[model samples]
Target: MKLHGYFRSSASYRVRIALNLKGLSAEHLSHHLRKGEQRAADYLAINPQGFVPTVQGDGANLTQSLAIIEWLDETHPEPPLLPKEPLRRARVRAFAQVIACDTHPIQNLKILARLRELGLPEEKVTEWAAWANREGLAACEK
Candidate 1:
């Protein structure tokens, strides 16, 4: 088993936590996102999305950190990462989607890059990130 990820990626961090909880060790491969190494041909072959946090194991390739984490939790159920009850699990999944789908997609490097390309200053960039985070947290309270 192998995991290709960057250290600071929240998605990668979730995978790390899930792996630790599962007590399984896969070969860790770090693809530097900042240096744009994730866009390189070799890594793109592994993940067409050209993103970090790609897991290859059991002759299968998996991308999207949440999917990988859920796969781990589903397959290795020793310390369940999610609640057991179906309804409760649904709520938990909604919460996870708040981060994975809503918050993360906005604050990701690609979005930031687009913001920068639009001539937005650093302060505005920070403000955008903070606002997105705040909104996500506010949604959680609802």
Candidate 2:
């Protein structure tokens, strides 16, 4: 198995933790997101979304950290990550999506870069990220 991701990416970090928890090992391949290495043709072929944390294994390439983690959990069920109960499982997934889809996307490197490109001041960009994180986490806590 191989993991293509950037070091500082939270999405990649989540996958790393999942892999560790599942006792699964994969070759680490770093794509410098700041340098825009993810946009390269080779990587694009592997993951059209050009996002980090793409797992190449089992003759399939998987994108999206949540999907990859769920696949890992399903394939290796010794240490289950999701609850068996339907309602509890839905709640857990919703909580995870709050963090992954809501908080992380707003603070992601690409979004921050775009904010800078759009002439937003550094302070404002930082404030946006902070605010997004605060609100998303607060909602999750509730």
Candidate 3:
């Protein structure tokens, strides 16, 4: 198994955590996110989106952290990550999505880079990130 990701990627972290708990290991290949290594042609061929936390194994290539985590849970089944009960499971998925989907993207490197390209001042960029993080975290906290 091979996990292609950057060390700094939160999505990558999530997969690593699950892999640890499940007593699984993969060949970890880190693409330096800040250096734009993820956009390399070789990586892009495997993952057209060029995002981190892509898993290639078992004749399958998977991307997206949440999907990978869920696949792990489904396949491994020991020490299951999500609750078996439906309501609690739904709540847990909601929380995960709040962090992975709702919050992370707005202030992610890509968006922030685009902001910089659009001539947003550094201070303004920082402020935007802070606001996004604060708002998303507040929701998660609730």
Q: State the lDDT at 12 in candidate 3.
A: 96
* By TM-score: ranked, best first: 3, 2, 1
Off by over 4 Å in 2: none
The estimated TM-scores of all candidates read 0.92, 0.93, 0.96
Each model's backbone clash number = 0, 0, 0
lDDT of 3 by residue, 17-120 (tens): 99999999999999999999989999999888878989999999999999999999999999999888999999999999898988998899999999999999
**Between which residue pairs do clashes occur in model 1?**
none
The 10 consecutive residues of candidate 3 with the worst lDDT sum are: 44-53
For candidate 2, lDDT tens digit of each residue in 45-128?
Answer: 999988898999999799999999999998999799988999999999999999998889888887999999999999999999
**Residue 142 shift from truth in candidate 3, angstroms:** 2.1
Those runs of model 1 whose alpha carbons end farther than 4 Å from true positions after fitting are none
lDDT of each: 0.92, 0.93, 0.93
lDDT for position 72 in model 2: 93
Q: By the lDDT metric, which is better: model 1 or model 2?
A: 2
Q: Rank the candidates by lDDT, best first.
A: 3, 2, 1
